[model samples]
Target: MPLFTPEKAQTTDQAKQNCVFMNTKDYDDMVAKCQIKPLYVQLNGVVFLAKPLAECPKDKIMLNANQRKHARISLLSNIQVEPYAPQHSDYTDLVQFAIVPRKALPFDSMNSDLLQKEAISQLIHRTVYDQPLTLEFEQQFFDVTAKSQTLQIVTNTTFFKFSVPHPASKNLQLTGDHVESAVVKDSQLMRFVKQTQESMKQKSDGQEQPTDDDNFELDIEFLGVGGCNKQFADIFRRAFVPRLLPPQIVKQYQMQMVRGLVLYGPPGTGKTLIARKIGEILNAKEPKLVSGPEILNAYVGKSEENIRNLFADAEKEYEEKGDDSELHLIIMDELDAICKQRGSRNDSTGTGDSIVNQLLAKMDGVKQINNVLVIGMTNRLDLMDEALLRPGRFEIQVEIHLPDKVGREQIFRIHTKRFVAKNAFDPEISIEELAELTPNYSGAEIQGVVNAALSYAQTRMMNAQAALEGQQVSLKEFRLLKKDFIRALKEVKAGFGKCDDKQIQLIQQMGFLNSAGTTPIIQDIQNYIQTIRNSSIKLGTVLLHSNSSGTGKSSIAAEIAKTCGIEFVKFISAEALVLKAATEMERCNAIVKAFQDAYKVPEALIILDGIEDIIMYTSEGMRFSNQILTTMLPLLKRGQGRLIVIGTTSKFYGMQALDVTKCFYKQIHVDGLDKTLIDEIVQEWCESRNIKWEGGKASELQCIIDREIVTIRALLQSLEQAASGCNEVQCSDFGKFFENTW
Candidate 1:
């Protein structure tokens, strides 16, 4: 057909409907010639499904302002309209689109579903991408942007994802069939709509909108809690949303609603915080918060009555609305306090067991209520009853573990956001560095670190004010420097991965240091520490042995424990156990307790110093304690959390005979000093300590080094005694010392 000049219609229903005006003669001629069904016209490299305007004059084709603007053509430009026949792959029934207003739209002023109905009614069967079609509603223009995949030929299944304005959409979600869902495989346009919808929802909930640069995937973020995006998503998907499904669909599908969830992890890992925010995020009824101890009453039957009271509101709601009631959230902190195993203890009154029975009845009884959601938080999951954790009860268990490096960094940001916003932090304060500095800090500990840093800053400000005379201190000048964080690190120690300074100090006082390149054995021990740290294998054991005593085997084991960088390190010394416990059974009990404590931490290093002493080894008939060995063997080899057990012993051959060597993953032999090493160490010690040594005169020292092995500990002790008060020493003086010592 010959091209006709496009004209903009200022006031016409055809213009608002994105239709092209054509004269009666031209429309009849084109329809008869092409016989195109669901007529489509292409202009200016863009395609649009066109509608005929019957009120137009003959020989003229009309272009509304929206159609002309969408094609980027002017009124004076003549355009050739071609019928669009889409290929097989170029069609899509559903198009997820977005509506961007010229300004922010107020809540309740527009309906998202109605706007979608109008846009889809006009632009269906049109291939559109990047070009936006304007729809006027309530004297406001909303730009409807859709991709080519979403805006193709419309079908009966054609559905658009429409997002409502904040606060208004909280109660008025899109009705009937086109609500937000991932039923269609997610596309770029669909992802955009999801992000926009979540953003609006968050704003409606009165939450701080996430910045464009924030990369957290989950929709919920609670104040004073970080690194729990995944856990929150799991709880919402598994426990919260299922209870909100319409009763008819749930009944037809024969699906039981998820009513209970258990959040268990190490203390200070944010389990309680997540439980408290469940009701706030879901916009459900205010959660009935109760501590596990608070549920128990001193009087008989009162505890069971307290348990029944928690479900009273939900029971009433279920009676009124059946399956259509609003969700009722009940969060119980320290759940293990009340939910102990049913027969774990004998109660005279049976009050505790009855409380458990009452809770079970309320959660999953024959007359079940579907409106209630229970979130239980506990530090000790093993103490809870097995029946409570079964599928029909609190089946969803989420472990709120210690945060990783990225998670720790996010937690630091969350805690320090207010300080950062106020510009109270110095330029050198790096959140990433703070995260690295704290390896095993929980969410609560990270918050404590921030508070500690602020305290340091406050102390510095007070000192400055005290030192200056007639000088006013300004709050704006309060800056948190790098030194404040360093000092904060000292104040707030993580309970999990803490270095034992007292044990390290005792080792230093004993004058055993592997820090210098004194021997290749020290380097070998360091490599074992690094291997355990990097390995994915969760459980491992290393044994360090020497044939002789005072060979620094225990010192090397302590060094390994210090450097392993695991969350827990237990130094179980046989000497300390003997001192603390008089009976042999008590000593064995203490040894077992140490291993059990190590299991509670995610990653741990246990140093069994003097393993022979713990097993009560005696050379005279090759006697040892079988009970202690039995207690230590399974604990060393059992695979659970990430654990590395370092065992040091002076009796290598004895351990081999007992088949204890086979239990370890790796074994390294530590050697005493040879003759050549002894000669070098004596000369260096003499020079460093400002003592004079006449080498030729020390015949006894030379004879001992050549004929017998000398350990570092033995040599150092003799040197300290011989050179007690003398600035000058002779080799003949060593012969006098050996005469008395050897």
Candidate 2:
């Protein structure tokens, strides 16, 4: 069943002669005689026919019958065969001789066609000088040629052609000449290849021109124009610009535009929020929000390495992909943790300085790597390295200050918009007035006020649940809620409640004038005491130009009785009037009371000591409040009793508005402390108590205090909160207090 085998073979010369004759029958006959079934036959280096063993010719005659059968069997079973070797001239038909049983092929039997062709090829090589033979098949003819002793083989459908190497003598001079010629040709070809390669490279480099789409610039608007807020925003925006560009191209441009930005301010001023908003506005492609702690590394150089890798990776991404829109914004909040002031010897220089130097170099390095923006946020800007702030570096500095009246109003409206939209108020109160009352209120404080008001309303509704209170929050409820909201705010002391130089000056001015007025003694005392307390003096004086109703005198006296630091109290009435007995005895007792009060509390003064009553004749006749003249006459004398005092007036013009006689110590015409001062007092008071100053700022403080001139009782109530731990005073506190008093 095998197509070919070693047992059935032919002499190479005989096979070659047969192939030259182009006799298919003879070839088949010869193969049959040899009992060789040629599955594939190669002639003159060309394959003529290749078929399976079973498909090969089966007509070759063999003896059959008794003796003939025995001979045929002997021929089939014991035919003598020998390995074929071709003479040099036999190469002409080498292709035919190479075909044998597929199994007998020297190469792998599985690929007999390929092996036959290889054998023919080798015979051709060995006999290159031998003339090539032409074989004419049914459709075509083959021609084989040999040149320079190298085999040139060609095959057609009908014929195969071959050329073989010719033998030549070796000559040193000639060989050298050929070698030199070959080298020169090779050198010329290599130069052309190199030139072509360089040209292609140049074209590729040119195609990568930087585009605007790869670069981005952001403009962030911040709080104060002249303050750190704007500077910081600008610096941050610049830092982000280079990050938007292709790093490689951007580097080529050598424009180091992008750098880190840092913002710092008071705690509640919204520093972090503003930074986040900036990121949003810039619309970073890939924003990395990191805290200061994230950059810290335990290993000496690891942190710096990590930082370098972070930026490097970003740049590499842009360079490799050529995506211009890719942006990596690294926002480092609390930047002070790692980038602390540089010169501290105790700090870890290797770790800290490495990070600092690396960050510094990356931010504004001369190399101009684009596509990375670093933003640093901190509450402690003072603690950062100065190099980080240099022009090419962070460059921009922004500071957010406490909101002013207008800003407070805007903030209040922003926070309360939801409530207002729900029809919480029938007629909205003047926001300007609210803003005025909330002095030193930050954005957080305004928001807290709105929240407090809403919370108060909710609480009230819950308490009235059984009454079937409507879901709607009414104007009345809102007002009441607002009042309670304000009152609660007075308990926080952290904001602007602490007395500063301006506040102290205002208190001193108010306390001076209240003691000089002379009207009905009781009324004068009331006016003076109210003015001093409303000024938020905390420690000061009250002088009353009054007599009679020492009950009213004692009432004012009792208001600041619990003042912890320093407070003075004195009552002037009929008993002292009698002791003096002068026509101006009542006024003299009023002055004496002021002196005694000052003596009692050298640091503070309360002047309502002893005075019964005073009567005065007015321009309209009919004995008008003479209490004013009687009180002023003694106060004008200026004796040992010259400090500060509170005065009241039941009747105006009952005494001169001013005592040119220099009678009373210092005259602080008692009217009312301004809206700003009132707001500050409440804020200060609440802050001391550790209460949150939610809404109701300085202006609001003033509005509530001024709504109805602050009375001695109101002052006592406001001050009483100081004992309850509500340190910071807010406008809302005074508003609630006033509402309750009403």
Candidate 3:
């Protein structure tokens, strides 16, 4: 039962006289209104003894049933009080004349806790008064603390001032200033910052600040963490600073920070670097960074013990200090090795199951340790146990995906800054050009490109040194030329198995990226391909459908297979299959042979281009046997791990008549290029051709839509004519090209 005395509506004086409960905050206020003595009050129709204490005791209420510092009074009551507890007692108590509805709400009488789906959202208007007794009288402490009277916050090195509004007023004035340090000294603000710093200190056990590893600042180039400031801001501030915030303020706002976070993504995208930097910023005490192999033992129970030992230090501190425990961060790299889905283990040892259970128990099990943070990094999120990823465990998941064009530019600037600063770099080597060249490169891969260029410069010096055997090599003339970077581009190959620029943007426009919440399309496609390869099911069909020709369906099918890292992708059309055949019978045999040949490869995307033509389809009043249709249907169903048939067709009505729509498992509609993609094509084409496209972007898009469904090929052809030895092509030129071509 709720420990409250429900009361009916009465006068303010009567309400005060009858009220039986109060909190620590309202202890003095309640004392001013009433006498401190043993009294009897009605609780759930039963009478109980209650009293107000002379002092707050043991940080706990002495009148309540349990040894708790605070009581959770229901928000349904309009009145509130802060109850005082005697210092020797362990229980903290506050009794309230809870507003009992004349008719009970449907939510009442269900249970001690409400249902999950139903939540109470109410607007609370509160009043505030300051306690002059709590204020410090010393002037020196006041002088040092005056800076934070106008509160300021920082993000991306820019400071913005903020002020607390009083209950009666809506506005609060503030003054801004530059932030020369992350340190704060004001008494109230220091309560938050100092806690955050100490929590960070727990990772390293308050180790002395290290000497500079290099004279150049990491912020100057942001090495190992290039191009990630914007994305990092949200995760860093939320995870780091919020925990540093005043606990009462945080509770008043109904917000929480998860101690467990996972950073999972592709290889070399800098998940570990981000985790290390975070640990550094938090100043964690002996921050543990372990790879999966380090903990996995051959012995069954030993593996689980290793997992326990990882948290022993932090758990011990939590037990000793309770809420005052320091922050502990454990970064587990390649987490899928041990945390595989609980029952997914095939071994007789059952070690995987034990390891997963041990990790989960440490995270949110019965003990409820709050100071430890587990940061798990993995390339395979799918292979991990489902229970561990849910809320209260590793709930904060962020994907460290490959860099985009702009991100790539920022990365390039960082990687090449050293050479540029020393004036040993080529002026013609544009950072933008290099960024554009490597669309899906990871941070490590981009760093490799810089290494490759340095390697070339070394080779040039070696060759020069060989020419003059006796004299010292001319270090003065050693410089990186534009050709050296061009050479490195060929030798390094930062991005190998990725989609072309156009294909990537096209996929993005098709809402593939919008569907991706934490994983990028690259990972999604790889996972899908792996499923198709490993699953017991035999067949899957992907259809690329468009209403008109030149939709680049064949190109897209091959690109999809390529981006999926499939090496053998075959394109089959009537011309390639039937040119050598002497008769219709021979042509059918050849087509069947090509399909059979495709099945030989371990995972091939066989693109059957011009699907209607492949089926002896004709529109000029000609009829054909349904033998081809029958043979293809069963063949599609029988396809196993080796073959994935992707068929393309401009005509959907023809497929309906043939009754072969069911053969295709997934049909992706290939449509006209959206404006964003159109812009990329136009700008790149004009740039290469040394021609200017003066046509307004909106006008061109509208004009194309106004005319007809514009294929990328047709758009390029039109652009070609407009840029045929012209200084600039205007919107009017597009009209001429559209009219003349279409």
Candidate 4:
């Protein structure tokens, strides 16, 4: 039997008010041909609406055209989006768009010169008008074509950013027979659809806040399953740890079971894995994995019906089993697809809003089903609906952050255990050293690193077999070497290494002894930052200058920006950009674009790393464009917006020309660490390395610094070597470190 009564479209006026007007300019008969359902009609002076096929008076909802002539769709429900009845759809799960892209919209460029960038943006904006819509979902139905020009777009997330590579037309048409779009199953289409939404949201938001999935802490009890410790901590510990306790005890204390648990982190950080484990560990009964489009229907009312149907089984089981009911686990992967922040998209057709309303009602519904548990996972945590993350909803929100050094070590051991057990991996494999090298590698990335090394070893064996031709290659003799691991480490880079409080504290402590010199350097910069914050100083660029060898002026500048409580810090390393962008124009554009991005965030700190490179100062001649310098002066001046620009320069005088030097509020000199500061650094390094630093050792370290050290970088290196060697810097070690130094 049908769960609920479907509403009908009453009149043309009602249609104008509720339904999207089908303005078929090219095809007039298309509207008539379309299946507009819940169609109301007056048959022989009686107004009537047809019921669902499950609970209907007749077999067909629509009668002959002669009788249907007066039948107008009072409400457009039961509309068959597919040419045929959707075979893949589940009544309990609601609408499932299982279509795959046989053909896609050309996003390369617009037909002619008349197409503006805004026009293309408008096209995309228009395309995403209905539902919690995604590009791929829309792409399945329509083809975005220009008048004459060739266009292309890239959906290159993970490897590259999804961006509009070329301009598109203003009146770009969307017309196609969307019948043959199904290439894969329902779950895949929904994944592609939601992923498209993520890309679209990112493109629209302007600010690209990077997702962090570096390292994860794994449960010690689950060594074979070790790597995602933080994931387990955030999920199982908070949500299910209490479930393990005696039911009577939990009830006596009025212990509340979490209604919903959300595991939000970067991609490949084991959010989904955590959810799957919850189901496995608890042995949840009939655990439902609802992708975004599971409840979304093309027809009105049908989608809502689908939402109701999803909970029907759980509701029935709860009533039958009462308090002794088994847990009904609902794992909603990519929660952002259906439950994004309310009213985020202005052009929303209320379908997403209705879905959220249904979910909210079900979660906090009148008839309490304590047995049901909803676990949501998403890469885009910020985009999820606020109400969904409220106290009664997904109350326990834990961040699955990147693991530290120790966490990485655990991850390494787990990933390499298979080979270790088989003796195919050498015992001499330095897991600690490998962990250190893979600083910001995610759990998945760490697995990749191990797999990469294994691949190399396999390749080596294969090569040997091929070269020998007749000789039998020994598989047991071929083991993973240090070089293979090193090669993998070199390939994978630590992503998004932001400057935080630790970096700031490191700079804060490492200062000269005297109050007059470098000790006051941090204080001076602090004062400038305060001035900018209070709006007392004419907000502009501040230069950190140093003639001292390896003085770390750039490091100080970054630390200053971080310490100043600035949310938006755009660290523009001129050297990083200038090297990549060969032309002077390209270099300027890169810098200017970064500067513009900084302006997007109010009270932003733009750190100009290696200022000399931007100015093209080599003490001989300046080859950089004068236009760039002029453009930079006003931007550096902080003429508008709460902006603070901090730049570092080894040669301060070289910036005297190009009018850039005059822009700085003050030039603070960064001096090398004094003897006291050196000792403090050495002590920390020794403790971190598990080396004793007391009595004779301290004196030896001080002597080495006082005699040979010129910078904190050099001091740390010398101390590290000394601690490893004999817990004290030998006089011979000092001579070897600085053979030619005064």
The best candidate in terms of lDDT: 1
lDDT of 4 by residue, 1-742 (tens): 1111123334433221212222132112232354533222223332332222222222123332212233333333443211111122211111211111234555422222122222233222121111221222222322222111111111111111011112221223222211111111122223333443454455457775555475322243232444555556556556654554434455578776677888776565556766776665553475788887676788987877876877787788766644444567888888888887778867557888888888888887677676777888886677888888887788877655555566678778878877888888877789888887765566777888898898899889988988999688976878998999989866654442335555455554543223213546767878777777787554667788765445667556655665666655666766567567887778777777666545433456778877776756677655655765665777786644567788887776667766667888787766666655554554555565566665335444454455533665555445445555575554446435533333
Task: Give the per-residue lDDT of model 1 (tens digit) for 107-155.
Answer: 4445556766766666666555655666676666666666332336555
Residue pair clashes in candidate 1: 21-62, 95-150
What is the C-alpha lDDT profile of model 3 across 91-205, one tens digit per residue?
Answer: 1111000111223233312211111111111101100011000111111100001122121211122221111222211221112221111111112222334444454356456
By lDDT, is 1 or 4 better?
Answer: 1
RMSD of 4: 25.6
Q: Which stretches of candidate 4 lie over 4 Å from their true place?
A: 1-224, 227-234, 250-254, 293-297, 301-306, 470-472, 497-542, 545-742
Candidate 2 structure lDDT: 0.44
> How high is each candidate's TM-score?
0.68, 0.36, 0.45, 0.44
**What C-alpha lDDT, on a 0 to 100 scale, does residue 516 get in candidate 1?**
26
Error of 4 at 223 (Å): 5.8
User: Candidate 2: lDDT of 117?
Assistant: 48
**Lowest lDDT 10-mer window, candidate 1?**
180-189
lDDT of 1 at 655: 90
Clash tally, candidates in order: 2, 126, 27, 15
Question: Which candidate model has the greater TM-score, 1 or 2?
Answer: 1
Candidate 1, residue 98: how far the Cα is off, in Å: 29
Provide the lDDT at 457 for model 4.
Answer: 92
- Model 4, residue 582: C-alpha shift (Å): 21
lDDT of 2 by residue, 1-742 (tens): 2222212213333233212221345445556655544322332232222222222234222111221221232334423222123333332322211111211222221222332343354333333322443322222223233322322222221112121111110110111111111000122122223343454356467675444653422212222211123343344435443433333444467655545567776666666766665555443444677788888877778888777876776676555533232456677888888898766538545677778888887777765544556677786787799999887667776666665555566566666555568767435465676676665566676667656666666677666663665465444454334465455455332253233334333323222222222224435544554555466443333343322221133333333332322223333444444566566555555555455334322234433332113333333554434555555455434334223444433333343443321343333343433433544554454455556555554454554545645543354365454334554444465465665652
